[model samples]
Target: MNSSPSVKIVSKCFVKPKTILEESKKPYYLSPWDFAMLSVHYIQKGLLFQKPLHSTDTLLDKLRESLAIALVHFYPLAGRLSAQINENTKSYSVFVDCSNSPGAGFIYATSEAVNHDGRTMSLLTVQVTELVDGIFIGLSINHAMGDGTSFWNFFSAWSEIFQAQESNKTDELYLKNPPVLKRYIPQGYGPLFSLPYSHPDEFIRTYESPILKERIFCFSSETIRLLKAKINQVCGTTSISSFQSLTAVIWRCITRARRLPIERETSCRLAADNRGRMYPPLPRDYFGNCLSALRTAAKAGVLLENDLGWAALKVHQAVADHTSEKVTIMIDQWLKSPFIYHIDRLFEPMSVMMGSSPRFDKYGCEFGMGKALTLRSGYAHKFDGKVSAYPGREGGGSIDLEVCLVPQFMEALESDEEFMSLVYF
Candidate 1:
């Protein structure tokens, strides 16, 4: 697995819409939050399969064919982003022009990437690696297109259609359950052009930050159990969840590694999904971004001095604050002041953003193949203080954290005795 695998491009093409799907050429407004992601390129998601195919053409054709079918329903992914201004308000907003463009980019690659540790090692970096018996598929979608939930909704649908095609069944049911594209925003919500901007051109300019070291840390079920038990013991309570416990430990370790002043405020920004928390719950198939970030902060001294339970309590409380009433109030706040959404964080110093959910069964995404051997974020995400978690391939309530941090802090974190004791590479 350590050897550098060779990857060769076999074909490059666009998986255009299956039919001349007609719609109003009107643009879908990018929510205030969606504007923040404009400068960011598509988020890369990947899947590894071990199914033996008769030929590379067989796999590529199946993928392109199923993608065309999937895009028929999730057409926005097939479109491009453009900035539009409201003449009367003299303000601007971003929108997706869903008119038939050349569909999503499709690449077929052949590689010799190795598989180990229950999954393919660094397969995402390899475009197409051919082993004796398997192939890997990589997918990219603009972040403005949707958040993880929406992205996965499309992924699940695509997987369903692929499976149906294999079984000679029609995927009309999937097409019928199309994503709801009407953005649910409070009336009179204006363009988010007024948000604080450290860099005024950020929306136009791509985010380019200093190089970051990416590492994958795996926490076993047994390690998590011990950590949770220790946190519960510290608080004399057993209510703290595994996520809160892990976040608490990682945040503390990261802070200590930076060697920041103990008096400085250190905060963890966690995204709370609002799909089911709204007054009228959004459809399970609701597409696009519906995330609200909650910042839990404490003096570095408090975090460093206290046990993990203290940090867990703060995380728990921050999450608890997102009740239906709070969600409604939040919508009102964003409508009244769109600038409150923080896009400036992209250019600012490192602050953690956690994504992916163990609740989502990534391991179960079948595509005619038996099952995915491994699933991961496609790129070595270089954003400062970005952390994404996925259910471990080992499948015993374990978690794998993809951490992107500055090299110094990464070295410090890797060497930290307490942190390393609970983590495996």
Candidate 2:
């Protein structure tokens, strides 16, 4: 692993919206998915090109300038979250006060190391580092603002602006698709963020954990191909995809490494994107939390004792079950009790929160200089079982994973022969 340079904080401030909104655009309600993330920050790190820039001041100025422009389109991100209480029910719902009340937070820092990989992330909290030659931009957006898709949409927009300015094409810098801000609720369904039960404090009571060890593991295209073929051969089916194959293998391997009680139920919670899973589909640039979680669970003994293909089938089935009807039903269910996710189990040993999608182009994020050296979360997502998967930077049908686990289980995972054979440090 490459060592990251020492980073020193230069400044930290909020980047407010450059343009003001009309009185009609002051407040926006968070969707049920967005409301669920009220207590947390969605932190992401991006590494700029390695070549040295003119100066730190120059780089920071450009960043702040582009951010201000980006905020014009994503103005709600510059707003603060507030709640309104219902005296009759004694419950409150959260909404984004988009009256330019506050701005997105920004930090400037320098690192001694050349590259900041997953190895350098803090187990305690979200952190960002920069190098003399390159800068690492860390974003800490409130989770209630959007999901991964929304995060990237805003980021890509920023990059587009930066790219245009860097190339002196500011006049041509226009958003192809502006964010769709229309809030959607199922017919006959009441408000999703009903209070008391959906209170931010109440949700935080679930899944809060102590520090956990996080590491990134890369799997090449050939290894993934072989795993998929082997699973197909065993199961006599060709329908399984590379993602299902890899996810199945990793899940089983982690279970074996944990060495949990054989009969205990172990669950894999997959964060399913419902962008096109709706009846008519959402806008391509729909800016909100539109995620549906699909879960697959089995006894530890059953998962580990079967052939790899058997576990892969479970994953395939779990994904296949998420039809359009189920997605609407999920929304209906959420409207009934939006705040309760039973996420208390997520902090337990037997559960995993699988996020980040291979379908999204993580490596294509360009801030005018070049593609990012790497993209990662600022903090660990799960204590014992969290997995974030992305397409490999190598770009030949490969995969990469950011895994967080308990210390002992991580040690076991490090030494597991079958798991390590396909993994690169």
Q: On residues 1-425, what C-alpha lDDT tens digit does candidate 1 reach at each position? A: 11133544556666666764666256656665565454444556767888665677686678678777777777666665554455565455555666635656675542221111001111112134455667776555566556778767777778788788887775454454578876665556643333333333433443344678888899998888888888888888878888878888888888888887878888787767888998788887788778777778888888889877888888878887779998788666655555422234433354566766766667766777777888756542357677888888887889988888989999999999989989976
The digit string of per-residue lDDT tens for model 2 on 258-357 reads: 8989989998778888888889998878988888768898999999889889988999999999999998787777676655444454345667667877
Candidate 2, residue 43: lDDT: 40
Candidate 2 Cα RMSD (Å): 5.6
Residue 106 in model 2: lDDT: 65
Local error of candidate 2 at residue 244 (angstroms): 0.9
Q: Cα lDDT of all candidates, in order? A: 0.67, 0.69
The TM-scores of all predictions, comma-separated, are 0.82, 0.87
What residue pairs are clashing in model 2?
4-113, 5-112, 5-113, 6-112, 111-130
Query: In model 1, where do residues sit more than 4 Å from their true spots?
Result: 1-9, 20-29, 86-89, 108-134, 171-178, 187-202, 340-350, 379-381
Report the C-alpha displacement of residue 105, candidate 1, in angstroms: 1.6
